[model samples]
Target: MNTIHFTNLPDDLPVAENEEQKKQELEFLKSAFQTFNETTRHLQESYDKLQERLNALDLELEAKNLELEKNLQEKERVKNYLNNILESLTTGVIVVDKNTRITTFNKTAGIILGMTAGQCLNQPLADTGIQPLAELVQSSGGQTRMEDHEITTRDQRQVHIRLSASPVQDPAGHRMGTVLILQDITQLKRLEEEAQRNQRLRAMGEMAAGIAHEIRNPLGGIELFASMLKKDLAQDPEKRPLTEHIISGVKNMDRIISSLLLFAKSPEPSRQQCNLNHLLKDIVNASADFQCPDNVKIHHDLAVGEAVAAGDEELLRQVFLNFIRNAVQAMPDGGSLRLTTQTGNTADSRSHITVTVADTGVGIAAQDQKNIFNPFFSTKDKGTGLGLAIAHNIIKAHQGTIDVESETGQGTKFIIKIPAWDEN
Candidate 1:
């Protein structure tokens, strides 16, 4: 602190000293005022500029916040869209981590696999009971695509599948897991098989036609001569055996020729409203005298009343006769034969009569089942192999289908469908 001491001369001082002191004080005050004004002006300008900069920053911050919220909403929308697509896909989609634990099993996947998404998620791929998927995980090196891979389900139903797999990776190319896409192709596979079968049948029919024409004339003469020889040697026991052998051989050849012709012929069915129940009864009665094993038993489950079908009675009779004969022959060891007939509607809403011939006999081998209806294909040593083929043709001519269900050692069932009489 600076102390200023004023002498008594300040009240009444000498003229030079007083005037000088007063002038100096006045100059000092003017200088202080000028400095204060300059400082105030500088501070005001700085404050104004600072406030303007803060306002600009506030505006920028608000804009950024809005933009950030918009980006977040857009990202959320994209995420939902992707999720919906994954859920809606028909192909089974499965995603697993590097440890082979399932992360995502979509709705289609759950349905096709006979499992729920909740049941499969977090479960190991190997534990999912899907061998192809597990194999994909084990063999996953890079992207892989497989088609028409067959798999049997837990219920013993076979399914054909197509699979595509790729390893999920990050931006740095580190392996994360696998993404698998599965599609069911069982129906498509059946169509292909049917197409192939039709082609083979067409060719076989053409070939059999020429062969039947060449063989039938000779076969008729042989059968005639054998019959005459049998009549001439009827009294001689030793010669009778030879004649009988000749007669049997000729008869067998004639049957073969006849079967071949029947298989090759495309007969236009003379459609009629025939009662299937009566037809089936007539078939059973006609076969009553046919030689079957003594122990063999035949049971009937024919639908009562009018089991009417629209087809040529003769052709249908032949079809049923062939089926019944096969059933009887199959039960060589004296097993039961069930003949069932019922009325039903097909998938296209057409009424049809279904006849099931199930026999507890030596069942057809799995490998031979597909070719059972093909010409010249038979499992029996004495079978001409043309009976079922002819029966198939007749049923097809009537716009129906024949299907067989059999497993080795489990007997066999033949289901024949013939459209019922529709007046409309």
Candidate 2:
């Protein structure tokens, strides 16, 4: 504001002015004083209005600050929620930015890839040392999705993987990054293959059973004719030997046909309380007299209390005998043959009979162990290759399982599990 100065008298004021002039000066003073009073009032009114505007601005700023803070807190809560969901998933999750740099690596991702999150997070996909994932992500710039793509893990275990790649975009439809989902389907794949293999085996078994029936028809006639011939040639020594040979060949063929039928068309085992201890002892005695070498040492660990099984006694005996013979065959140059039996209950509270036939001899080749129970698979030249196969069928018919464990140059062990008889 500009200041105004007032004086008591002007420099050119007339001396001894009249009463009217004095009165005029007084009125001028009154006017200047009135104007000063009005100016002061106007200034006060303006200051009050300015104060109101400042207070309003302060209120607006505070409201805006609170709103901004709330938005930030909500965003943080959402981020944590999403992280929790990703972490809890069994399937693996990996995220990459537009530059193919890994942005998020979940725990499942770390486990499936056999790497740590720190080893991959924020790193370029190309340098992560996981080629399958890198190539999959780089394929079509992560826009194209790959589903159920199988990949072998770093540890060389075959894993069935269902991998998918999807692009991440912002609300404005702009390209942001990519997301990769991984799932382990190894067990599912094994079950699928096992189902397919079982179907094939079933078909093959049906065909073989039919062929066995067809062969048996002719074999019955041959045996009858050979018997008649043997009697007719009984008086002639040379001719009688030839007829006997013919009959012997027919019998062997019939025996093989019976074995084939047993393998192909497995018979249902008669449910009975089979005492494995007595059965095993009888088999051991028979083997000692026949197939078991004099140099081979036999050790039995058959306990007294491990008694009964819910299986046909004859069939169970056949299974155990087959295992014993295989174990003995494995040891040609004198080795220990161990046979053990025990009764145990499984986690499901079902009792089972555990039998192990192990030997200290040249072991089966690793490749052959899987095929040992398969028909016509044998490493020995004289092997008809049906012994273990028939044994496997009988065990299966009795609701049992058989598995072989062996390594090249190491001893082999056969583990058999059968459902035990419930006395209750």
Candidate 3:
């Protein structure tokens, strides 16, 4: 082997190293560089695209969050509005679960039921202790409809309540609960009752006046002839008895005619300032002369106040006398009669004095109660039935009112309200 220097290379030495090897080395190097550059560009493009996608996603999420917040706010607003409406409604509203447990009770419900929301909430229908309501709800099936129900209050007051019940259901149509709307018909019922009474009174009055007018002439002739016959038969003993009977009958007929006249006449009230307490005391004193039974007891609860009213004294006296007499007659089996007088403001904010007569006697029937103030409508055989009618008219003339509360076999109470004299 010849020891040649590495720096000293001969041109075209070593047979030119194979052309195929050189070409292969060059091709491999070119291919590696191209692959590296392509990978780098692809990574950069992919990163940029991922960054754009992330930004778009973030924007979308932000918009979705805002939309969600808006929806929540709108829902809250709707909820608040509904709550306010329910709170402000005059008619009572109550929501109950499927088990009839109270879920919500509004302000008016509190007043009508005489119970607070705190007391009523979560209470079962049976636990409410309202007999009418408990019975009604229990009997009502899964029917979702409204019905009118009458309930008696805790104070023994009759209330006409209109109960409207609707079924609460889920979006899937599954039965959830019930929503009950309570409407107070006490005043409405009273007005209806008053209207009916007035209609009956008008009809009866017209008929009575017509009949009385026709009968009065005949009655007068009968009385005149009876008087003349009594005078002519005075000397005949046998005819005297018959004439006496005729005279007695004529006098009775005259008395009936007088009552008829009183009934037919609708006198306008001549209002004057008078002390009601004194008048009530006089009425009590005058009642002593009445032939009341020994078993009946009368009590007076006259409040010490300025009991001045603008009304007719004589007519008012008759009104009270009729009430007292009726009360006395009510208690044939011995019961206490209480008369109370007090001054108060009416629901309409009118200053008035109230006189109440309560008797523990067989009460007027419900059917009869509506017609009690109509002329010729009487339960008693002998009653002309115009006493209450006249009393009703007298109170109305005075711009006052009269109401009766009664339960069959329980008792009866009559309330007379008259406007107080305005000193100012």
Q: For model 3, how big is the CA root-mean-square deviation?
A: 9.1
- Indicate the TM-score of model 1: 0.75
Tens digits of lDDT, candidate 3, 1-424: 1122223333563554645555555676677667777877888899999999999999999999999999999999999999899899999988888888988889998788777889889989667677656555555565656677677766555678888777778999887777777889888988997888777677767777788788878878987887888788889999878877886876776666666666667868787897788887787675564565789887889868678888889888888888988888888799998989899999999999999999999999987887788777778867778788889888898889888999888889999999998866
Displacement of the residue 372 alpha carbon in candidate 1, Å: 1.9
Q: Which scores higher on lDDT, 1 or 3?
A: 1
**Cα RMSD (angstroms) for every candidate in the order listed:** 7.0, 6.6, 9.1
lDDT of 3 at 171: 100
- Range of the 10 consecutive residues with the lowest summed lDDT in candidate 3: 1-10
Q: Estimate TM-scores for all models.
A: 0.75, 0.66, 0.69
Q: TM-score: which is higher, 2 or 3?
A: 3
lDDT by residue for model 2 (103-173), tens? 99998987887778898888997775666777777785737677675665666545678888888889998
Candidate-wise lDDT, in order: 0.83, 0.80, 0.80
lDDT of 1 at 170: 92
